[model samples]
Target: MPPITNVERVYQERYAEAHAYLKATNSENPFMVIRAENKFIELLEEPHIPFWMRAQCNAILAGLTDETADARKYLKGAHTSLGYFVQIRELATGSLSDTAGHRLAQLREQLTKIERDIAAREAAKEQRSAQNLEDDKEMLLEGQRSAQDLEDAKQMLLGPEQEMLHEPVVTDDTRALPKTEPKPASAEQSLEQGTERMDIDSDRSTATLFPPHTEVTADSSQHAADSDTDMTSQFSDNESTATVKMEEDDDEVL
Candidate 1:
């Protein structure tokens, strides 16, 4: 076989690099995967690279990027490349290598799996969002009902008290009347009656203590006057005798 040309050598180097980058997708480091995707994108820009290799590289890049739309595009390109490869192989005398066929099959399977996973994730996200909305609605309704019930309870508890406060009060107007003229007159009459009864009682008591009185005649008045003079002369004689005895007692003491 003739020595490989410079173009063939460059294509081999780029193709190996792209495959190496694709393998890094399984690495734990996200930076490694990102770097690998960038290298694969560079491979796509090379003119010497075959269309089938470009398709596989794009599928690997899309998988590393983890984007649904990019994965779908890569899947489409991969299918087209696969169909062309099959047609070319049937017409050619020698078929493509088993390794190349295996790589194409692997690329197709990976793209299909990516599409299915994206669909499942989107469906799950939608279901979670719907469930959260239902829960929020139920919570809001329950809060409104609780607030309404509390308001109703407050009204029920305070209704009678409010009515009692607002009710009209009944009172006896007569009890609040001012003093009248007839009341003073009645009070003065009672005082006068009490004074008259007291005076009459005193007079009756004095009469009971004194002797009874008889009619006065002219001769009886003269005899009573002479008796009064004799009584007065006897009182004077007794007083003179008391004075004479008091003097005799004083002389004896001296």
Candidate 2:
């Protein structure tokens, strides 16, 4: 005899229990049948069960159930299982039954819609990312421009200040020269003194050059006396004028 596999052993045990439950005809023991159905459903969930078989089991469960909600739930699970099994089988065998082919076409339509939605979302995301990058680039350029403007402004502001700092400064020590005290005799005073000296010398020379004849000597002496008096008066007038001018200067200064 062939060695009994784990799957076969499990199936045998489950079949025995289910057959026993079905064979019991006690009208008061409906719970036993329900328990058997639940057990069968548990077997369907096992990975060892073929997906197609599980789908068939779920469909039978849906038909046997009286509750509309439970029936729909079972049917939906059956449809999902059937779709998975058909996709896997078609990949391996490259062929499908009519029912599986129709189900696959419906799944393909759903897949196409999902793929389109995903592509649209990705495209929108990429567009947003590109827009954000462009915005960042613009912001960076703006910042650079602003920084450059600030630097230019700083240079403009500093230019005149630097020129002023470099320019030569004229302080009292640099500009002032040592002064000499002025002599008291101005050109006018010196000129008057020189004229007076010349006149006196000429008169003395004239007096020495010729002693006048005795009769004219008395008249010459009288004329010389009158000239001497005029000279004294002129000297006095010049002194008064100089004094007045000095007073005027002093008043202006005050």
Candidate 3:
């Protein structure tokens, strides 16, 4: 209150220094340039310190302590800086913590999207599998029906096939199939029946299979004509091909 003395000026300077220190220690926020200059003037005018400045001084002392190796190291790098702005610029420029945090967040989001897509794909695959299984079942049913039809046909022909196998020669019993229903004869079989009904041989051998036809054993000259096929249309129409069936019957009309 009285005339400001050197002791007061010294005390004010100490107080401002303490606050500045606190700012560095994280106890006080960063001082504006004008505010710091004001503190410089105030320290010369009065010998008292504010609560905020006092906190700053405490923080400053903590940073200055020899055991605070991390603070010392940071301060060492800051020694190259001209002002607080350099520190701000260095922090804002590129920080590993910030980049890593951003990348981690992005990766987490991507992972979530990928997981959702995978789940959807799996669901679609399962649906497709189910559909395919259903289709396969239908196909199996159709195949079963076809197989059953084939089995029925085979069963129907079983008796006829056995009779034919027992005797390759067509007998009276084999010509007439069993009651289960004889398989319809092919065109070849019908032709064979016509040939059996009409005794027309390709070779002039006296081999008469028909009862009505007379048995005749021919000599060499007749053999050539017997083999020739210039015959009736009705006989050729019924049986296109002539088989060389010969007979050794005792009865000879020709």
Q: Which candidate leads in TM-score?
A: 1
Candidate order by lDDT, decreasing, is 1, 2, 3
Score each candidate by Cα lDDT: 0.72, 0.70, 0.55
Residue-pair clashes per candidate = 0, 0, 8
- Worst 10-residue stretch by lDDT in candidate 3? 27-36
Cα displacement (Å) at residue 5, model 3: 94
Q: Residue 39's C-alpha lDDT in candidate 1?
A: 58
Model 3 regions lying over 4 Å from their true place: 1-106, 157-254
Q: TM-score of each candidate?
A: 0.34, 0.32, 0.21
Q: Please give, for residues 66-166, the per-residue lDDT of candidate 3 as tens digits.
A: 53444334433443342344446558875436775566556455445534544565586699899999999999999999999999999898978887789
| Clashing pairs for predicted structure model 1, backbone only | none
Candidate scoring better on TM-score of 2 and 3: 2
Report the error of model 3 at residue 222, Å: 75
lDDT of 1 at 177: 70
Best by lDDT: 1
| Model 2 lDDT on a 0 to 1 scale | 0.70
